[model samples]
Structure formats: structure tokens, C-alpha cells
Target: MILGKCPYCDDGMIEVREKEVSGKKVKLYACSNAHWTTEDGEMFELRADASCDFRVWQNSLARYGKWLSYKDMKDLLNDESIEVELISKKFGKKTYYNKHISLNPEYGVSVIWD
Candidate 1:
């Protein structure tokens, strides 16, 4: 069974359910009382199907047909479509972009995933 920890209520987490998505095995786990679940954003952070995070990040970077202007970002990630923003937590946008799109640093732009 899937294993995890619950910082909110229960200490030990266990698998509660399983499902298939796009022909991939997906297991859902819980923290005893089933308050929180292991799904898209919580526990299922890895996609064994994908090559790697770097490749995924690079693809996202390349999706921009051409270098997007500052204002273009606002429209591209609108409320109706998607929400995007620049954030600086551990490293600034400039740093992260450098590592992601090293080939085209000038084309790098931060678009928050929401």
C-alpha cells in the first residue's frame, strides 16, 4: 500500500483507493480519518510516464511560440484560461528560468501554474 505521513491529524497514512488515468495506475491514500487525500497536487507529484521535471519544465518554456511580451503574459494566463504570475521564493524568477530554459534565456518568462 502507499505510505505517507499526516501532519494535521493522523501520523500514519495508508492507501484508501486506487484508480486509472490515461492508462496509468493512480493510488489514493488517506490519513486515517480521510481528511486529506493523495491526489494530483498532494502526493501524486511524480509521473513515471514523463521523462523528467526538467524536460517538462523545458517544454512549458518552449510552448511560447515566440518570446512573450510582459503584457502578453497577462492575456495568455487570464482568469478564464489560466492564472499566471511571477514568484520568488527560494530563487528568483530569473534564476529558475535560467535553469529551465538555458538554451533561450532571453525567451524565459515566469508563468505561475494555477
Candidate 2:
């Protein structure tokens, strides 16, 4: 499925593909020109012609114990001031807090947990 346009490259579109791992199916999202590979390091032919390396894991987009939808991810890519509630674990306890999420080309998605 096409999630949205790529923020890194002018002519790239973000696409999601499914792959089976450990007897389970998982989705991997990446830009059309992304040099992404499967979990086993197997590269996709469609992604071989690379211009951008924007890729993200499906589970990595989760916040507050819930996975974000494609639209939500798109919104996050567009807005820098978007804050998300995140659940943190410390001393066997769960704590919730809000922080702004940012997409770094070198670091992927991240938020200030500290």
C-alpha cells in the first residue's frame, strides 16, 4: 500500500510491503527509492534504484501502546509540533508522558524521553 509521499526525496512515494518472519507476517514501510531490505537483509528489487533511504518499521511508529495509522504517520511527517503520548517503563512500572516526535534522516523517528 502507498502510505504517502516521501519527505526526503522529491519523486519518492512511501510504500508498505508485507513479509513473513518467524511464521508471522509483518509490514515494512519505506520510500519507493529507499535502499531498504528485509529483516534477513534481502533487498527488494523495487527498492534497488535508490535515491532516498527513508524507511521505518511498523512497530516503531507506536505511541502510548497503540500503533499509528498511515494517515497519522503522514501528519507527523508534515507537522513538527505534533506531540505524542508515550509510555515508559521504569522499576517495573509504567508512566505516560507527552513529547514531540521528530523524523531524523540519520536517526529515524525519535522523541525526547528524558
Candidate 3:
């Protein structure tokens, strides 16, 4: 249960562990205080019920170039009526201006180019 500060509940620490999700083993972090758990290390929490065709989004981003912007995904997901929970007050500026947003390669959220 090694963890850093809880991304969801800043007051509590996080506990990193592996759990089966959607039939796959995912290493997710859970808040020590039971605030939240996520496969993305709590970078941002996309509600489990969020509905959006990830393939469509991935294709759309590919057309633009390499790397998908968080804002782009957030906007589309929001339009699709998917709720996104942000641990941080704002989507970090790192992805602004095609700066390449990071995604977990294991999750296959987007295609990777070698």
C-alpha cells in the first residue's frame, strides 16, 4: 500500500494496489480515507459511467497529429454527458499548444506510434 498524497482527498494519503477491473488487472490507487480510486494514478477521474467512443476520439486526435490533448477529450466527454472529476482545480497547462498529453499505455486510450 505504498502511496503519495491522495489526489482525490488531499487530506489523506493514497494506497497503491492492484485490483481486477473490467476483467483486466489494473494497478490503481485508492485514497486512504475512501475518497476515490482510479487507474490513472488519480491524475483525473473520469466517472465510470462516462460514455464516449474512445476509438472515435483517438481517430480524431490522430488526424490532428501525435498526442491527444486533455482538454480535447474533456470537451468531447462532457458533450457526451460524461462526468469528469478533476483533482486539480484546472487541467494543467502542460497539454496546451500540442504539447503532448500523457496517457497510460497499458489502458490503450490512444494509439502509440513507434
Candidate 4:
């Protein structure tokens, strides 16, 4: 279990648990020793809850005609609400910006997000 640091708590990876409520069971990730909630009883998923961060960040960056550094990309990936492992398996590493050439020749060239 290689866990990334949680941005909100500035702590290490989150803890996962499966709990039963009513007649349904759901998986949730929370801080290692902290429970966060509002007076409204809203729940928050840990920083690692989703894997869309990569796509979100990358797509945003690419749309703005910018290239993200590897470290920045990693940060984006660590803050999603989905399983990054699964996301990685789908998108792989580099994205092919061009239908034929993928930001080759010039890595930082501006490109639109798919």
C-alpha cells in the first residue's frame, strides 16, 4: 500500500474502511486519526478519494497552453477522489497531444486537452 500524503491534513496517506449503513455498504477514506465534518453533517473524502485530479489538472493545463512538470503532475494525481492506479492503467503516462506527434520535438509546446 503505497499511500501519498494528504494535502488537507498535511499528513501521510489516508485510512480506508468499509462500513454498513441502513442496508448499503460503501468504502470511504479518511484521515488516519481525524474525522472532519461540518455542522451540516457533510462528509469530505480524503485527498486521495478520486483519480480525476490528473485528468482535471492536465486537461486544464493543456487547455491553457501550458505543460506541467513531472512533480506538479504527481501532485495533481495525489489529490484525486479515485484510484490512481486504475487511472494510470487507463491513460498510461504521456498523453498524445497530436493525432500523430505527441508534443515531440518540443515538449513544452502548447496543445489542447482532449
Best by lDDT: 2
Q: Cα deviation of 110 in candidate 4 (Å)?
A: 27
Query: How much lDDT does candidate 3 score?
Result: 0.37
User: Per-residue lDDT for 65-96 in model 1, tens only?
Assistant: 33333333333323223233333345433322
The CA lDDT of each predicted structure is 0.33, 0.68, 0.37, 0.34
Per-residue C-alpha lDDT of model 3 across residues 5-60, encoded as one tens digit per residue? 43323365544445554465544444445433366542434455433212222332
Order the candidates by lDDT, highest first: 2, 3, 4, 1
lDDT for predicted candidate 1 compared with the true structure: 0.33
Indicate the TM-score of model 3. 0.29
Top candidate (TM-score): 2
Q: Indicate the residue-level lDDT of 57 in model 3.
A: 25
What overall lDDT, based on C-alpha atoms, would model 4 receive against the true structure?
0.34
How far residue 90's Cα lies from its native spot in candidate 1, in Å, is 23
Output the better candidate (1/3) by lDDT. 3
Q: Candidate 2, residue 38: CA error in Å? A: 4.8
Every candidate's CA RMSD: 16.7, 3.4, 14.8, 13.3
Off by over 4 Å in 1: 21-24, 35-114
TM-score to native of every candidate shown: 0.23, 0.73, 0.29, 0.30
| Ranking 2 against 4 by TM-score, winner | 2
